[model samples]
Target chain A: MLEYIVLGMVNYEDMTGYDIKKYIESGISVFYKASFGSLYPILKKLANKGLVAMYESNHGDRKKNYYHITDEGRKAFEIWLETPIMIDDGNGTQLVKIYFYDLLQEDKRRELLIRYRENNVTYLKGLYELEEQYVNTRNKDCYYYKLSVLYYGIRIIKETIKWCDDIIERKDLSEI
Target chain B: MLEYIVLGMVNYEDMTGYDIKKYIESGISVFYKASFGSLYPILKKLANKGLVAMYESNHGDRKKNYYHITDEGRKAFEIWLETPIMIDDGNGTQLVKIYFYDLLQEDKRRELLIRYRENNVTYLKGLYELEEQYVNTRNKDCYYYKLSVLYYGIRIIKETIKWCDDIIERKDLSEI
Candidate 1:
């Protein structure tokens, strides 16, 4: 997945490893992100596979290399775009934690749920701000497409907040 | 994560590796799952660490080993339950694909969104059935807590389906 993300990003514009990391952090950090530990190795493998080409540019005293998608890379990325998305069946840490939350007492469970809900609310606010920025931007061919993905993030967070509220409300009803 | 999950399940009952796999497959397979390749080694490591104790039981002609959580195992599991859930910054494969989807023609893009929405709708329907089942079950202490997680899944899928519909509808508006 990281490999394809790198190829797709380079297909947009040439980038060094540092640049790719920065772009992902700024843009799709909500849904997709890669760390330096994993990024460099995937870049090297992409280069070896002839999916991307690297060229060095002089930045003052330092020579920085940039990755650009090759013809083969473009072809491969097109194929990938047409492929159906994989069902995500793993790494749902939040839900997994909640599943075993019965180990805690009622008060403790309540405290955790409250805290988790607050954190999600805070995160959702940031996404809304991002949505505003994207909506206001003009003339980018990919604007709505990016907003579509952001909407997914925002809506999921909203649903989570609703779920959290329902759980808390049920607790209140029980107490009454 | 799988380690803690195995420990949590064994805490509920004595389970052999096969039983553990089956239990996860039937239950938390949505958010947490493991293949035998990863599961067996983790079990062996947990046993070596004395987090779980193994007992031999005869199953007809075969001797089967079952895992039971130790006192230490329960303590460890308790700590894990209280720990904050990790944020999932990676593996949003659908949104990642959608982000670059402008590269495709509009008709193709609409087709993908429709297909994506249909799949989400199907998955959400199954979750609703599971939610109904949980509601009807009696005498399960952790029933509501488990329902809370299932609700999260249902809500997210509903949100995704909505996003897909919104995008497809916007495309229709533009075309008209």
Candidate 2:
């Protein structure tokens, strides 16, 4: 959550609750998920904890709530930055989804495959473009991570596409 | 969750629940996560639904439950394979962590910095090994995706390290 918050800060300087959700979803792979229900509350908590400072502003007729990292927030972020994250054992969503894939009818599986392929293709193309964008604009440190993410995105899509082919070949689900 | 299940199927052809969990965490940079709290119930539900069928064995005086994908489960997985996933949006822990870095005391910030650096470096090294492993393996499609993840892993580490350096150069947080 903090990494994303800082990403918002890095990307937009200062933004409101709405901005964060928009930014993450637009390019943040299907694997990465967040909800506003938790986001707003988390923001409030961040402010309360003094990790983030909040403000209110009006744009046109709309009132907007804003948050920014405090110096204290930065310090805290730095500390978090230094810490190592352990890959604690937990549920794997991809596996669960696949496990139950057979529960869906053949047609449903086909629909899913088509949709998944389309999604991956679109995402991969966009990522390729983004790589160009980063290069064309000379985006530096702040932007390099985007490249990393994009690379992963494309790779996953390619692999998924291939996996779909393999499964189809092995099982011949369409014929069945 | 489905991905984890598939992982279980693919890794060693068949696995007990414990073996499944260990296989994923140790081998794949898997997207699956499961908890004992949820696993038993879900497993039973899957079995009930015919997505998975099970067998039991006694090992070292302990009862073991083993599951394998059924034709129905395979079909279900296939259908799911093609479906487009809805990627939920939400908080990024790293971003959130960065946002609040300023809240900590100087020593705390330094501590975070140290921890973050250690983590990134460790992960970065692991990524390098993965890349090499990918190079040596026949699963290029999967390895491609792994490489992509590693790419981001590297960029994120660089950013974190750079931030730590920036703090050291720009401020004297020691007295704070």
Candidate 3:
């Protein structure tokens, strides 16, 4: 996943390792995090795999290695983008895909959003059933803390569903 | 963190490795996850550390090893519960603390929630500042995808703030 994020970022524009880290911190830090320890190693591995090409650029007295996505890297990123969004995938996965949705065709983007909504709707139903079961049983009274945790899941999923609905309703994806 | 989670669960009641896994699936699967592979190793490590004790129990035709929290385990769990919640801590960390919050004194729990709210409030302010900067720059048109990702962070943080407010406003913590 880190590799894909790196690829996606470089697909947008060439970036030094520091630049990639900065973009991650500024853009997706809320949902995901990558430390320099992990970032540099992943960059090296991607370079070795021929997914990204690194070139050194000099600015004043500093020479920095800048990464640009190779043709292979772009293909790999597109595959990741089109992969189905599962109900159990982390929030970061969906967010990263949507952050690059402009690279996808409009129809494909709409399809992914609808699929995402459908998956969450199914998940929400399961959560409601679990809630009902917990309420009917002795667990509800003795385990309100666990119940609150469950409610947190329900609330977040509901919010995600609402976001999907709003995006679908908006006639223009660009405006979103 | 996995060790702490294991201790917290065993601190509640004696549970077999299977029981802990089931509880995690039902209770906090949304925010955190642990597979049996990792769970068994942690359980073994906890026992080795004298933080938890294991004993065999016969259930009809089957024998099970159940983990019980030791005196040391209880102390560790308490320290974790009282630790300050940071703005960048994952949602799982906060939820796990709250799941065992009943073990803490009423005053301590209240303090943690207040602190949690305060931390998120600070984070939300930074996000809003970033949003304003993004909107004011050329980023507004060309990078709406990135902006949407930023909005995801903002929306989730706002919901979290509201949850904190709701919890704080309720006169009774037990009802939460």
Q: Per-prediction DockQ, in order?
A: 0.19, 0.04, 0.44
lDDT of 1 by residue, B36-88 (tens): 99888989999999999988999998999899899999888766654432324
lDDT leader: 3
For model 2 the local lDDT of residue B29 reads: 22
Task: State how far residue B126 of model 3 sits from its true place (Å).
Answer: 1.1
The count of backbone overlaps in candidate 2 is 77
Better of 1 and 3 by DockQ: 3
Model 3: per-residue Cα lDDT over B23-69, one tens digit each? 87776677677899999999999999899999999999799999999
Error of 1 at B46 (Å): 0.7
Query: How do these models rank on DockQ, best leading?
Result: 3, 1, 2
> Largest TM-score belongs to which candidate?
3
Chain A: TM-score in each candidate?
0.51, 0.45, 0.91
iRMSD (Å) of candidate 3?
3.5
| Candidate 2 chain B weakest lDDT stretch, 10 residues | B85-94
Candidate that beats the other on lDDT, 1 or 3, i.e. the better one: 3
The Cα error of candidate 1 at residue A18, in Å, is: 0.6
By DockQ, the better pick of 2 and 3 is 3
